[model samples]
Target: MDPNSSKRHLINQLSPEDLKARLANESFKRTTVSFYKYVILDKPEEMRDQLFLIWNKLHCYGRIYVAKEGINAQMSVPDHFWNEFKEQLYAIPEFNNVPFKIAVEDDGQSFLKLQIKVRQQIVADGLKPEEYDVTNVGQHLNAQQWNNAMDDGAIVVDMRNHYESEIGRFANALLPDAETFKEELPEVVEKLKGKEDEKILLYCTGGVRCEKTSAYLKHHGFSDVNQLLGGIIDYNRQVETEALENKFIGKNFVFDNRLGERISDDVISHCHQCGSACDTHTNCANKRCNVLFIQCDSCRAKYNACCGDDCQTYVLAPADEKESLEQRLVFKRGKRFYKTDKSA
Candidate 1:
């Protein structure tokens, strides 16, 4: 790696306090927030540069993306500076009050730096622009309301990937056994082809996927489709507002160091090995196939963080020798062996 890239990568790994202080005595305490807007952007690179300059000044830290289709953002800025963040977001014609979802748990270390990248799709669905009408989305519902709709025989489908749904979902939500975001979207739609007018509830980690997904369903003739307003994040938020019981159970898996956040007293997902109902998600400790995934405490120890015995040796291998061993393993088995489930 180039020295500059390596150094930048190292900086992004700093601790929360160190990162806060290292940003050079900024004037506010950061409140972490996240949201995505899936609208067409004319100039992705220009959009990326423009947001970077504006956000870097606010000491914002998290990830954001811009594409020909739209934008997705997960960021932290000073609590006092939230207005500034909001203003900057709304200044762009497309992002006005665009419903961003908050994470269920607040970790001081959720993000270390601000990053903006330009991509082809905000969330890669591998579909052409004309595949589905992206404008007409489903009905929106708050936590309490969504739960009520579920009671009325709504086909509550977990709108996240299988692993994500495995950890947390609405009670009895039909999980699509899907391994990817794009696949699950169509799968969920196909599964409910004839049930267009029935109450349909959809949800995901931060609710952005459903923005386009709900639109797709609406285009496909699904009438009474609805989604959790802010997804799990907003669900947790309203859980406090109405003092409603947490209808969703277990831990909400996240894409950061803090892993999963608590939503209720119930524990749903079990340790893949020991079967203890823990919601913590961890990557396989094996360096070669370090799949970003979920595992519980007991399983963490049992696998020594590797997820399986094949990975165990790789995790224990000396750093200098690890590369050659990885090459050899790959040369012998190809990518199929790497795809084997190591989800403990």
Candidate 2:
């Protein structure tokens, strides 16, 4: 073996601050794009290493998950390298012809660094292998068809977790009070117990969760299960292009650094701190208590961008007493301080 080959590291070693600085200093433009494909991979670890090298060479920055079942990725690529990135990625047999969903609202600073992780499953549905057949998914519907179904009284269900749907969803969609997909699956089943044969329309951020959810519904004897073809992302895109009636209201929650993108001007959700109308999701400034929550500009200033008074005190406390203060304060809302259990 060559001695120089030992120096090749497959992971990023830069700190977040350094990565952000590097991105800030760059002169070129970047485009935010996301794509996922559920194709079987014999050796995910090897594939991960290969992809890291490929993407790193292209100066791409984003998060990607690889598993035996498939791969899911969301990243920003330099505009100059976009064509090359597409060509090289499409050259891979497993991901050949995979559809790309470009961010409708992009600021180019979506990600600061590259992170490719190997997981047991890409989306973390928490199910045994025999629970449902992914290959046997529900019918895929475009924006027009989905709207028509809604017009005909088809049941609309948000397949995302509580925090995601808290900010936006279809006008009459059934929003589950689930914190995780594993919990949501059973909850949805119970909610639709009596209407197994009725039309079910499920949607998520980028259509990945709905892929599994639609199949799970079918496994539980749901006959007319359907999903948004590309989820809220594509639905919004089509709603703009085709000039269709937009049924979705508020911001569409995302997993990137931006957190979310606006789908409409309506601020349906309220600030978790003050109950003021706001849809902006932000994490507490207190590093130790980085709970995700919605905050308006006013509460943000009052709380110093922390979740609540306790978190704000903890953040402002001197470094010596910070630990003791954290120990003494029994946070009013527990670990996830701002999480809501209420559902529509």
Candidate 3:
């Protein structure tokens, strides 16, 4: 009997506990990776289904979003099938020669299940086709070039949301105050209103956001605009490989079970609960209030990994009551509570 045969016959839907147990018992390791490309697609739904089928067969699991604009993917593939997965990906005309940015640190459980969906846009910058020409993006700087730009005192901008940038970023980078990519676009443009002609550099987690942002800045008449090619993940990898100066301090916040990867030994951010110097991000344990926040070890033990007293109480409630409360609160305020500008 083949071990992978059982997985092949398994259905997509599985209870969270069952999925976690299965992943734990698996013998082989998985490689986590992410990649994105901006290219035209005629039928994203068809493409999504095809990719889901192919990736599932390869024992891959993660979130994937495809659109007419392009595809954005983050997945964990079984180590043995990695080459086959890449070959199949390259076989597709659209994804041919696409560069994948492997995760800096992976625990083989970044995601529990496979999910591929079709969306309107890949990175959701809230710009209409008439608003900005994405093809007119700024210059792409490799690791060394990016470091040089930083040394030359280029105005660096972090194109990620406030929560994402709160944990880590390039030293002196302009951290935007917005919550989503949509809001960040306009806010960043306004911030650089007077310095359009100055040398402006932009970066994000995986370079996808900066790709759209640089185009937006250029469309708004920024003369000298550049983006860190492949963003912080690639930058960290290059810095380690080439022994270059790592100007990026603290952990790089990522969207996975491993919330971040340490680029340097600097803990630049403080815990939200205790105000202790920490860069670790964690979601509230209370299902009703799964707000993302920073917490130190002491705070985590005190709050039981919940955000506050109310959340701790909710999480400690009976299972049946907890589910009921979660339904009511999530329906009323959505799944997560976002801090307002004043509160933030």
Candidate 4:
């Protein structure tokens, strides 16, 4: 059998449970890294296929999106193959010298399968490209500059969604209550309507969202706009290494199995189920009702890691009965599953 075919067969044969168990027992190290760049791509679909072949061969796994605008990738690569992976990535002219933001915490289970797709936009903000010059984004501020700007009382805004900022954010940062980036841009503009002349700051999980948002704001005539150079992931790394003041508190929400990483020893968010102060995010155990929500340890045990009592009861039903119930619910409600912003 071909080596690639054998590897594919092995991956296909393993169930999610089997994959999790295998990850737990594996001894090799894996590095989780994220990076994004906005540059014109002539053929994103072809690029997507090429990347998939390379990454899959190296057993790399994560979510990667390629678009005409650029590429946004959050992937886990085996430590032994890390150098080779970087070499191949940098060989692509557009991705040359792209900076990577490594995760602060790595458990080697951040992703279980390699997925690459071509999309309309790498980081969707629902903005027309002709309306705003995305290349002319906000000023890039390092950790020190961001801290100084905060100390100077600049109008800092968390450019991420409500659920993202609910768990962690910079002190005194204006967090818009919008759910998606598309909703956030307009709402943020409305919220800071009168402060167009004020020095504005923005940040997001990996800086991709901020890159677009800051451009949007600047196009709207917001003066003196700045953004954290690499977002919170890089900010936390710099804070620890440079001994800078950690202004961000609580857990930084991440899109992976880990859900989040502790930036500071503060539980700033509360459990949605019991209202206990907790920052841990978990998806409902009942897959059909996989709502992402914060849950306390006590509540986790009581509800079997479910979102509510209703989901808990659903989990208790036998497999055959559960399937029947799901079908009935789908017919009655027009959908078997519902998701929220909290959904991972």
Candidate 5:
């Protein structure tokens, strides 16, 4: 590591309040957007290093992962800095605006610090590039366009992972069962094969994965494939600006601290146990195992912010004893067959 570089530690994440205050003081307004491209990169290490240096200087902040498979990013860039950011990115032929998708809700501190890292696969679904045509991709559509097509009986599919889709999705969107990105790609194509000539609309968190995924489907002879132009983020912005009719209902799931952005103001997701209309996705409070699950505000308060009674007990104990208990209950995600604690 370079001697001039800042120290790095997993536990040393920046505080959200601190970041928000700094950006506000700077009068920095940022545009939240993202995009992806699946192409074989000859020098991932060199690319990662260069990207980190460039983005950091621009005061850009967001999560970005690059692999030999492709590059995926979800970031917030200062509004005044957008021109230079786009110029520097397009300077690399592999990425040109690449038709990026802007986030719907803008939080000054969407990400803490600039982090560019190399990985095996950008989205972490272990599938080889040879399995599908990552280069060709699918058609792009906006919220208005996607909604109209659905009115015509088109088959709309949510291209995001299970956790993302569970919180906010198009009312009638076909959600894939796969927990990862790679598995869902081929599965969605196969499921829509019968409707090769029919209008097949696809969407995702920020519209990055669907870009290449759509191209892959077209390469396989899917006659008609359309994607949400800016994903759910851009769709939300359009709804607010144009006073357009809202087609997508419920909270639009986000990966950042804000958790979710409510589009239609309807509580679609329920508290895992109480069956109340709540749309919050939370991490399990079990100290030993950090499994992710959902719970409403009421349930969250009653359970003392834990997922279940067992988690409540574990959390209530002293730190050392809790650690000991965690070591004991440390088995395979043992609660897979269990239901969300409703008794709280």
Candidate 6:
């Protein structure tokens, strides 16, 4: 077999349990970081393979997506190899000096293995090539400038999904009831129908989403579009360093194991169950119906870490009845699961 193919086989053979065990035995600390760029690539698959080999050697682990458009990655690097990792990454012409958004809170075990795959686009915006000029993005505003804009009553919009923004956002931002970025673009355009000429600001978890969203807004004739420089990650760092007023409240939702990081001392959202103040997000403990939802500590204990009473009951049910129970149930509002068709 070819050398690269042999290595790929070795990598593919490691199961999730194997990766977890390996991570548990590690003694060194790791740093979680993320970065993205919209530069064009000639061969994304080749680039993916090359990066996997290089980063795997350095013991770097994170979820990464590469495409003809560019790369979007969130990974953890061993502390000792941080400098070497940066050097190797920046050596590539397309990614040279690409700004990194370091995670606000990191325990180093955010990812257990390195997984890279080639996709059509780095961030899925559901747009055609000729639909908009992505390079024509909004003005980048640092923490201080963003605060100033907010003080001046600038129209701020959360470019992320409803789940993300539900946990945290800038004060008074126009949040669209969207589940994905694909849905958000058109919704935002429709929401600000009369204010197309207004100074609109867009922001997301990292700066990646806004890079494409700002351009999409511009294509729809929104003038004076701006985005928070480096999104909330860098904004938090700057706010702490410069002693600027933190206009954003609540947690900054992230995609890694650590679901979110605190940017302020406020919990703007409530527990989806008990309605108590909470911003912590977790997937339903029921592996079969792993819906993402929020629960308070009390509720978490009451539901046995599942979504609600129904899921908790199912979890406690006999193994043989699990499949039959699940097949006969449907999701309900108060109780996550309930009997619908008894045929099963």
Which candidate wins on lDDT? 2
lDDT of each: 0.73, 0.88, 0.85, 0.85, 0.74, 0.85
Clashing residue pairs, backbone N/CA/C < 3 A, model 6: none
Per TM-score, what order, best first? 2, 6, 3, 4, 1, 5
Compose the digit string of candidate 6's lDDT tens values, residues 30-82.
Answer: 99999999999999988998898889899999999999999999999999999
Model 2 stretches with alpha carbons more than 4 Å out: 1-8, 331-334, 338-344
Model 5 pairs whose backbones collide: 104-233, 136-215, 137-214, 137-215, 137-216, 138-214, 138-215, 141-229
Task: Give the TM-score (vs. native) of candidate 4.
Answer: 0.91
Per-model C-alpha RMSD = 4.7, 3.0, 4.6, 4.2, 3.9, 3.5
TM-score of each: 0.84, 0.94, 0.91, 0.91, 0.82, 0.92
lDDT of 4 by residue, 233-338 (tens): 9999999999999999988898888899888999898887667798898887887767677788998899898776666767888877886666644221112212
User: What TM-score does candidate 3 reach?
Assistant: 0.91
Candidate 1: clashing pairs of residues: 39-69
lDDT of 3 by residue, 165-204 (tens): 7888888999988778998999999899999899999999
lDDT winner between candidates 5 and 6 = 6
Q: Candidates 4 and 5: which is better by lDDT?
A: 4
- The model with the greatest TM-score is 2
Show model 4 residue runs off by greater than 4 Å. Answer: 1-14, 327-344
lDDT for model 3, on a 0 to 1 scale?
0.85
lDDT of 6 at 135: 82
Residue runs of model 5 more than 4 Å from their true location after superposition: 1-31, 38-40, 78-84, 219-221, 330-344
Clashes of each: 1, 0, 0, 0, 8, 0
lDDT of 1 by residue, 1-344 (tens): 66576335322456767875775555446666778877778888888878887887876788787898888888877777788889888988988878766666674566678778888888877766676776778877988888788777778878787677777777888889876787887788789877987877888878878777887787778887788888888889998888987788876766655667888777777665566666666666665566554456666777787556667766777989777767644221212222234432
Q: Candidate 6: lDDT over CA atoms?
A: 0.85
Worst 10 residues of 2 by lDDT: 335-344
